[model samples]
Target: METELDIEEESDDAVLGSYEEPVRLVDDAAAEILILWATNQPVVWKQNFFVRQTSLSFSLDACGQIFTIIQSPSAMVKPGVTGAVLWDSGVVLAKFLEHAVDTKRLHLLGKKVVELGSGCGLVGCVAALLGASVILTDLPDRLKLLKKNVDANVGIPVTTRGYVKVLELTWGDELDPHFINPFPDFVVGSDVIYSEDAVVDLLQTLSQLSGSHTTIFLAGELRNEAVLEFFLEAALEEFQIGCIDQKRWHPEYRSCRVALFVLVKKSLSCM
Candidate 1:
């Protein structure tokens, strides 16, 4: 059964999501416009569509080079709103933790990794170039832009230490066959567990992707009390949780408190 809100939402999205080819003006200037995926629905990939209000910047970081996407007041990927995005929810924090597995870091030895909800694929981009096999996952709608980000940044193939692969994975949907590894050795996500409706699907995906030796790294801004409660309950099955780190994204940045959580999957022996 669907609620009235859901019904109306679907209707609006369908009506708004009509697309045609890019139109060219009399001069050489041209503009590309596409359907909004599902109008009024939350944007599946924030980086894909070119909106007038935003710009992407490549920033140098202590860990390595990562892209910074800045959102502005006039930017309207949607209607009447300004959005602040640090990194894709699962990607920004994953970038913070990359030292462990990155060859340049000299700490972690494993190179295989995956990031869910990779909005701009910054973390995966860095990892793949640093000599690890990295898989970047997000919705199909975003893959076009995600691929663009990869192409825009990495000029040479990262054959020495890393490889980047983009995958389309919606929360709760069945896992794609691209990953033959069965369970990933390490799963890192950031800011991914915010939506209450999407929590169960997220947990289900995590459970299916982790093993006893697997390390699951998560980072998020606490949206509200309900979000925290949902996480406590959803990921309780396989993970022996530990609150590893917490901090603000920027010193003066308000409403942007970030926390890092490390959960080790406990198999029968550990239990």
Candidate 2:
């Protein structure tokens, strides 16, 4: 007989698998997820949220990093859609949360960091709290939630630290030209590579905001060969790409592909 723990393990596999392939679950699948998450919400601060959670770099107030989260709104898709972006609160963001960003680990403190498609502003929030000047950004609708989170968290001093702010970042749309003299020192994007068409836009947008001193870290949850191949094609021109780490979450969801790169100049502004 299968125990409840076994059933939950199976459910985790099923949930992770739903990313790469469609799971023909009942019409109430979404509701079930909501209920499960709601039920598990309180347990986050208890003793069980440390096991697989959302894909955000949520800061845990206690000892050791939090290994779990419940950023459900960050993963909600645009109705009936499936694939990497579906429920992908940006796995790269989650990876950042799973892995800690130390101040001396390459001395990233006091630097300017910007995270694109920051579904729930996880990395940016952590970065800001960790002493870096971070801008948490995403699409307009997503930015609304991002703003709410920033407002709720910012200026509140993280035990002794500060908070991050939400910024509007539409792919292919560059920031104002006035701040070009002092561009961000670091740029981060996680679990953002999926669609084939958006590749060009994402790269082009990155190129504009980056400069010679800009160090960019990109994290992607590879869904297929095509997505990875297309991303490399689009991104190689403006940055020197190299893999840094790979950590598995589940069989269905590929381990997050973390790459570190230094931003160079582009020949022309595509944005």
**Candidate 1 lDDT, 1-271, residue by residue in tens:** 3111111233322100000111111111011011111221223334322222245443435345544433332333644222223333334454555543342322223356677776666656665665656788887766766677667665445676556788888777777765536455567676676667778888878777765445566766543446655565556554445443223222222122444555554352233
lDDT agreement of model 2 with the native: 0.48
Best prediction by lDDT: 1
Off by over 4 Å in 1: 1-54, 62-95, 98-110, 180-182, 246-256, 268-271
- Prediction 1 TM-score vs. true: 0.64
lDDT of 2 by residue, 1-271 (tens): 3111111234322211101211222123234334334543423333212323335334434124342223543354565222212223344443343343431223345666778777655556656655667777776666655665555554444433333556667788757653245787677776667687778888887877776456566655433456656666556554434333223222232322222222333332222
| lDDT score, candidate 1, position 174 | 74
Clashing pairs in 2: 158-161
Clashing pairs in 1: 13-39, 53-75, 89-190, 90-190, 131-161, 131-162, 132-161, 132-162
